[model samples]
Target: MTDANTTAFTNPSTFILLGIPGLEVAHVWISIPFCTMYVIAILGNFAILFIVKREPSLHGPMYYFLCMLAITDLVLSTSTLPKILAIFWFNSREIDFSACLTQMFFIHCFSEIESGIFAAMAFDRYVAICHPLRHSTILTNSLVMKIGLVILLRGSILILPCPLLARQWPYCRTNIIPHTQCENMYVVRLACADTRISSYYGLFVLYCRIGLDVSFIILSYIQILRAIFSLPTKDARLKTFGTCGSHICVILAFYIPTLFASLTSRFGHNLPRYFQVFISNVYLLVPPMLNPVIYGVRTKEIRNRLLRLFTHKGTKAFSSGVGPQTDLPGVAGW
Candidate 1:
């Protein structure tokens, strides 16, 4: 490469993140909702973790996975939004190259971890419904810990190369990333070097790892549906479906916007830049915000626990003189 082509890599200092490129005038206004969503995501996920930890009855494979999911959501949102808000609020768009890469690594790693947790939760549901008698024996505490470890390891190891590959590239072109976050493709495209390998590897990781996880989740649901249908009573079917409803909502919330954003980035090349950035931001922010809401509303145990937590702070005893039910519907086998 020419001297000019090597300049950025040699004196790598900072990268500019273009927050909502064409909407510079509206960034302050736009930040209102973004800030709201960030607060909601943080508080919501924290509540999930708090509820799971405090409620002894929630100690099970399903709630264990829910805790993992909450942690992942917290990490994922925290990894991206602080920088985004800074850019929007203060126009502090320049990020150190190393810092940018580090942010990208964490963003991708936590995202993949969430995907894996979703798949694990689906399997938990499968075991609970399709093999109820074996559920306890199968998803013991040891197995839960092992699965969590495997999910963490899988994301951390696979995502290591993403930042490494970006660091190796000589970014001689303009160092402006046209999105709020340091997504892999956005950063790779700014490199002066040929990025075919990086692009292909990113696609490989997406399809092979996340794709595989999504497929397993789908298959688990299929088996779960079969088992639900096999039950003779309508009440059994409805109860089983109700047990899975929150999970289904969470899965759809996580994946649909992500798929839409991915497809638009790949194929909607002619679409307006601001629209693309909007969708990308939506993909990251919406899932974290919605997850806890879905669970709190759909899962009775979590809802009651959350209610009791708030109510207890106001009074010494229940107003109705009835304690919260300890034998609430279990998450896995309700």
Candidate 2:
């Protein structure tokens, strides 16, 4: 209303993130669990990447797609958690305007890239199951490289406009973001100018880009299931199911919390602020923590490799002459 008030709002150089409102006093106490989870996510994903790189047996399409997924998870978690931890530990929540936009860009870009990787994984599964004889020929290293490029381009190009559009709108009232991260919608809501275009474009990207990928993933699974059921013996059916179980679990883990968080943010207007923030963290953090665990447990190769890794480390520490044992079940066989 007054020039003094307008100047006060527009002249602010940095925006403050109100990390988990009403729990400000317990920020330090609450950060312990989050710190532990972040460590696990980073270490677990990195281990997957390392195992795939070192093992010659894992140089196929499935494992390559997995490496891509691990990389995406690493980037996605790193983009959001550092600032959150800083807020909780050191009370550092001030982010410059351009810095905030940069954070927003990477957050959305890597999310889309992760979704695309999931779709690529689904297609790999489909080809392997539906056309076993042709799998190697169809999904060669060259094709994988091309697909990776397309996925990276799709996400980077589509997400570039989101922050660009948001930065054009001027903020004149408050710069306090309610969430820990600089999410696109949360940042756009702070703008005093019309934000209908930004809001609609965000929705468009969600439904058109991520939504299409999800649909194709479901369709690929359906076709794979059809092919598997046509096999003659029960043993064959069980073997096929075993091969796909880990991927199914990973897909469920990623999509369920994400959808729940999106719905809660949109429709749970009467819900407490902390509930919304909790779900948002769950959506962003849970996949990176759980994906490696699922793969290591369900996939025999990864589990054996991890076991050998630790065993070898232990042997070297205790005795220079002793070597790591390889008599574990599923180590010699597939």
Candidate whose TM-score is highest:
1
Candidate 1, residue 90: lDDT: 96
Give the TM-score of each candidate.
0.92, 0.90
Q: For model 1, what is the C-alpha lDDT against the true structure?
A: 0.83
Per-model lDDT:
0.83, 0.81
Reference-based TM-score, model 2:
0.90
Q: Which regions in candidate 1 have their CA more than 4 angstroms from the true location?
A: 1-11, 313-334
Q: Output the number of the lDDT-best candidate.
A: 1
Off by over 4 Å in 2: 1-7, 313-334
lDDT, candidate 1, 1-334, per-residue tens: 1343435444267877889989989999999999999999999999999988976667888888888888888989999999999999999988998999999999888878888888889988888888777778889989999999999999999889999999998876677788998889899988777989888888877885558989999899899899889989898788777788888888888888877887788789999999998998887998999988888887776777788788765334433434434212333322
